[model samples]
Target: MTGTASVADMDQLGADVARPTLRGLGARWRQRRTAAAQLRHLTTYAGRPLVALTTTVHLLAGAAPVVFMIGTGAALQHLDDGGAMPWLALAIGAFLGQQLLAPVQLVLSKAVARRVDAACLTRFTAFALQRAELATLERPEVADRLAQADEAFEQWTLTPGAAVEGGLALVARYTQLVGAVVVLGVVAGPWVALAGAVVALVARAGQTEAFFRWGQLIRGFQPLRRRATYVRELATSTRAAKEIRTLGLVDWLDERYAAENRAVLDPLWRWRRRVYGVPFLTYAAVALAGSVAGLVAMARSAEAGQVGAAAVAVQGLVLCARFGVMFPESDVKLVYGRSAWEALLEFEAQAQHDAGPQAAPTEGRITPAQAITAREVRFGYRPDRPVLDGLDLDLPVGTSTALVGVNGAGKTTLVKLLTGLYRPDGGTVAVDGVDLRDLDAHAWQRAFAITFQDYLRYEMPLRENVAMGAIEHRDDDDGIAAEVRRVGLGDLLDGLPLGLDTPLTRALPGGRDLSGGQWQRLALARSLFAVRHGASVLVLDEPTAQLDARGEAEFYDQFLDLTRGVTSLVISHRFSSVRRADRIVVLDGGRVTESGSHDELVDLGGTYARMFEVQARRFGGTDGSSTGAGDDEMRTVQA
Candidate 1:
């Protein structure tokens, strides 16, 4: 028997499964590497005009610094030489370098961000699209990484990426710092060493706080922001709106969401305050040192009759110290940003690469054959409890087989195993005699057409829903019109504003919706469309539960005619609906416990026999009772 997997377990498992995927704990180091690689990758323009253009812009920006530095020195020299024109011209050029570089830098950053954002999303979505089911998505560790990407992927490149901002900020500050050193040497040589020492010390302190803040935001603080986003979705999204209003949950949800968001922000905000405070204190320290150096330089140069040069030198040193203090702070922020980007890249790599446990092969298709078989299958969602205890069953190809079972008897799991939707914990599930795991997944999936018990009613055109069953060839296939007619949905299709193309959703304007039975017909049509397009295996998994008695009888009676050359596996909880199958097998606790024709089972008085007898009493005679199933006739019980 299966161990009860709790609601919490199922929901939390996805995040747990995802946690160790990008296994290394060195997220900081990894982020720096990923950030560098991404920037390098984006900047790598091939041998062409584009590369030349990129180089040209950067070269011009670099040249501006030299021009400005020279201009500043020249202006100071001219003022000392008592030449007004030289001082005015050099001073104007100095300011021009400072002004022109700002806007050009902004444009380049914006352009690079756009490309990087697009590239990251395209790569991650490609990885996610390869997953076979939502089961893996349930793991929260993976969900967290996935959520990080979902939350920050676009921002990594599109938004003011910490890396880009930090990188540019560092470069700008460093350039100014170097220029200040040169100007100070020319103006106040005595105080140059003192200014450099003070600026470096302030920069080191800012870097330390930045490192701590990055980790805090990425792990401890980020989840609260994600929780807030979920709250917003619940409060306003269309699906949640009705529930929000009906249960009087609007204010409660709003408050909860607000609380969760604040929980995340409060720590970050406090940390930010601390960060700013430390900088302010450090900035004051740098200023105090600058002031002492300035006073000494001023007294000495004035006494030596060089006040103008001394003033320029002191001002230049002050500017360098300020820019230097900014350098390490920016570096830490950039590295933190890089960490977020690396997380996204690591998750993408794992999702795309983890195919070892799946059913698909790296080779050819599994042979199409005359039977499906499960040999000694033992299975469970988790390893601790056994859901299927060495179960075995076989269904001949080119014939219809029915599986009947009570709830928790493992009917649905059996269907998933048979369809290659899941792998057995022990033994193998086989199609046409070859084990399902050995077959290529793409081909294996293409071989079967299934109408699940919970089949989707997609909000698309009627024809598109049917065509989805035969996805690849849907564009050129017009014979779906005939299948629509066969299912008696022809009127529904024709009566719509647009034949076959009418949107089957109540949410859309002038669109129509389907009742339970009508949608079953559409699902049936989807199955037929699959069969028409070369699917040999057809599976009906209790989706016909909504069908009236006559509708079901018509389906069973014309079963072979409808299926023709297909291999059909039918699942029904009600034995009467499935009694006509060539064989009926009873599943209990995930194993095939009984097998025989319906009449034979009834005589044997097994699970199938008891279920048959229960429904048979409803008809008032012998076989089973279902409205308009037949007039005093029972479906055959084959042996």
Candidate 2:
């Protein structure tokens, strides 16, 4: 499937997918998460040196401003006390620190931003690749999430940012507060100091709640922003661009783009007004009460004639503590900042699955009743609209089974259930005679290789695009090159500037585009490469849709040869291509209508026969020229 079709499919994938109800806030506070996780992720992908240097620069630069703030505040207080002329020089030092910080922060921020952006892109993709086969990515919900990916303000990456910045600010600001307290205590009693700290926290928390809402509102609008972005990119993309102009579809798409844009963002603006207006009003009321309480305390002291220059110390300390006491606001901001992944954090769901190697059974891994079988399967993407019902299917040892269906007949859904992307609501999908639910999703997913009709054309180096087939072998350069050759793409890449090293995307410099047929060939090569790397079963779901007539014929002719030793389930709509399979199964209204050899189906005059007859009529429709199966050759197969 092209990107456009993929987007459409994903948007429509509403009920069929087995998505868990989103719940819970992160139990482990954001402050408690390892700063090392993001750092380690970046270091591993982009190299330790870059990660270290960038982190060092970022931490130091980010901390410098707060250091300047506290240091300057201390220097000012020292100057105000008329303590020493030498302190004026120290004040200039703090001014110099402030002067030096801004530009340095800009540079480090840029460096860290680039590194984290690239690193997250690489690592999350690698993470997904570890468990995500074609069937997983083929799910519409997964595509929606992937398309929604952005670099603006990832909550995970920000853990390190918050740690470095928040920690430093707290330390530096607290030092300023402590210095002020010492000088004030020498003049005034400790009661003034205590009251100031209390009020400062209340003030900071109030302000932080107001500021944090603005942040959430802004970030929450992004999914819609992405939906708009998806349209713009799809319109310009290589595949969809052709159809967009030819079908005069730019306006239709632009409207959907505008609609989703409005829908996603409309909430942000509405919530922004409420979050900003109410919080500020509430904080203003709170701030008024706090100021009155402080004033009343001072007024009583003044009435008692206990006020003196020491009063100066009490008032100055309050101001100083208020400036420094923005700590709890930072904490509150931190919590609200990750509203989305709050569940992951609160749940402390950190230990990742260790994907043990999937053990392929000795008997071609298909005991008929053994591996990856669906029994009494029932599913629906929507209420009262069951797609697949009572479907009992099993693959015996060492065989190729092809699923033939018209559009929306649940061919893709079957693949998802078998591959463990979606779970059946009513029945079970079993692998190695164990229900998939009983097996680890990660390990179970790791066992199969699948190429969807909508397989990705990665905008990476030519070799890396092929390497995605079985990513464990990504470092195996020889294997990557061999797969490139095996897929008949050697000639295609040979003439490029750097062969397999040449970027497969024309969007970049020194990059190139692949024709539809070539991309299909590359996707096929990827699935085959996985087989070579020990994928027990191969699934090709409408894998020939990108191919032209000739490429389809060539692919069909080589299909059995390509999958000779592997158990295969090929889902296709084209009857001619699937007829040679050991068994051909037809689905109608989401139930298996027929299953047999082509000859048996043709003789039965059932659903398969009706479909075959309908397709056969395409041979000489309107015009007298025949373009379908040859008369005797077709008859022999049908017989």
Candidate 3:
């Protein structure tokens, strides 16, 4: 009874082990099928003719080895029979064909890879730009996925294009292996062929699994890799070069880079060591044993006169070919490339989820007729730390409003909400009486031309830089030139050798870099150009921050003219620059604390009044007597 119980227990354990093993195999099979389907889809991007040509080349190349082996065996048989030289000639031709087809296959494969890569890049860019809000791009998880997708363009990294090409090549290799196995079975015996094929397949499976695991490991470390990459960029990039050197941080950056790199690579290195240790040796031993067994079987058959010398030779070649195709380079490319492709798909899924349901397009453009108003608006970058809490404000049409606040007072956050880049967490932003959510986001955004505090300085031609504000009107050279002059860039334009055609960066030949003041003027000109092209609302956030005192004063002098017939919102710390605004709103503690013209606010002696008094004292202006009161208010606010 004890022995019977033991036998039953052993049987149950065997069943339990077999269950998961079978399930794992099933899962792997499904994954392979999915990979093959993806490969086929990507290949279509290469165009039918190129794909067809590439396929033909790969197949012919795969068959060359089989033809060579057969021809050599036949030639040996003919020689033994004292027959003609035709078989020998065929053998030579096959060998030459094999050699010649290799480079052609490589060239064709790369061509297909490049075409597929270009199509994938375009698709990626389109997907990234599809969302109307900036929230999706700002998420940490989405940023990590973006880094993974970006790997496709980096050197030595796997891409979807490479995966498709590798999949095709892998198929060709298996075709060759299948042909060799069949030829071996016919010439030698079924048992011998089966033994060799089993050994080769087992070894290949083990290696492929190792690589697949490595690919997954690499993918899991993408965030760490991005961190490491960022550190490396800080050490190497031109943007950080001056700061890094000036701060004497070279050694510190180097150490940081090393630490970040180790954090990413140490686990991968350990994995590689384990995989390449016992497992790799075991596979090598299995392959060697299979090769020896096959050779011995073929020799014994020859000795027994069961097969001729040619048959023995053919069987020997088949064994070598079978093992040769195992542990292929194509497996590495396919596995790693598939990981990158999967990352892109995963990003798309996550981004779609983050985007929620798409809003149906509202017909016609929604322009502000009377006012752009925020009613009890609330927003926060993080859930627990609200930036704008129940803030209410309004910008009437054809008037200028200046927003003033301390550093963390949510001035920029309010602008983002009003411009529809971010939706309020609560309440609503409205155009006239219409809620912003009801309006088409793109059309609403088009109604306003904004220049942010940190505006982009594109390194394109001068014309292209300004025309970026309204690209459809890029060819309107007269309008572009007029806007340039209107923004006080006439002298800069005249100094340029190519006028509007001069490139903005000195990195190019005949290109020139601008002074900070000139770049500010150019940025303003871009926004003004947008206004000329039908944008009726203008938003300027510290637009003159880069300009000198004279430049700032000049900008203020033209402020009314620059914003003529358009509703404008200006955000600035320079109270003097915005004193003439039709209205001034002071933001504090995530809410509007004061609203009036500059003189009215000063007379009220609130947060805005105290802030203006402090600035006036610092600049040796008139309001010296109120300095002590202003300082007391600022200290209280800071606390």
Best by lDDT: 3
With candidate 2 superimposed using the best TM-score fit, by how many Å does residue 625's alpha carbon deviate from the native? 14
Predicted structure 3: lDDT: 0.76
Q: Could you give candidate 2's per-residue lDDT for residues 1-639 as a string of tens digits?
A: 123332233333321121212321232224235432533333354356644564454455434433444444444555546753454455466567656754764454445445544644554555455534443455444443444343324544443233333333344445545555454444444544455555555566555544454544444344455567777778777778778899999899888778766765555555556555655566556655654554555445432233333344544445654652246523433433233223222212221322234334333322233445788899887749888988888775468898976666788988888876666868887866777766666655555778998889898987778778777688877887777777677788678898778898888899988888898888888888788887778899987777777767777877888878677899876676787688988877777878998889878987667657755676644221222443343333334
Where model 2 places Cα greater than 4 Å from the true spot, the runs are: 1-164, 178-182, 189-199, 212-318, 321-336, 340-343, 346-372, 474-490, 620-639
Sort the candidates on lDDT, descending order: 3, 1, 2
- Please report, as a residue range, the 10-residue window in candidate 1 with the lowest summed lDDT: 630-639
Candidates' C-alpha lDDT: 0.64, 0.59, 0.76
Arrange candidates by TM-score, descending: 3, 1, 2
What tens digits encode model 3's per-residue C-alpha lDDT throughout 1-639?
001122234334333322335777788789778887888888999999988887888788777777767667666666656752776677688779979988988898888888888888777777787662577777766777778788766753478888877877765676677767777776766655665686668677767766665566666666677788888877887778889999999999989889877765666676566655666677778777877787677656533353344464455445543553434447767887777778788778877776566657765445678999999999999999999999999899999999987678899989899988888999999988888877777778778788988889999999999998888899999999999998889988889999899999988988999988899889999999889998888999988888877778788888988887899999987886678789999888899988999889889987777777677776677643212223344545445
- Model 3: per-residue Cα lDDT at residue 203: 71
Count clashing residue pairs in model 2. Answer: 11
lDDT minimum window of 10 residues, candidate 3: 1-10
The C-alpha stretches of model 1 lying farther than 4 A from their native spots are: 1-73, 76-111, 131-135, 153-212, 221-228, 266-337, 345-354, 357-367, 500-520, 546-558, 616-639
Please tell me which model should have the higher lDDT, number 2 or number 3: 3
Please report the TM-score between candidate 3 and the true structure: 0.89
True lDDT of residue 318, candidate 1: 58
Model 1, 220: alpha-carbon shift in Å? 3.9
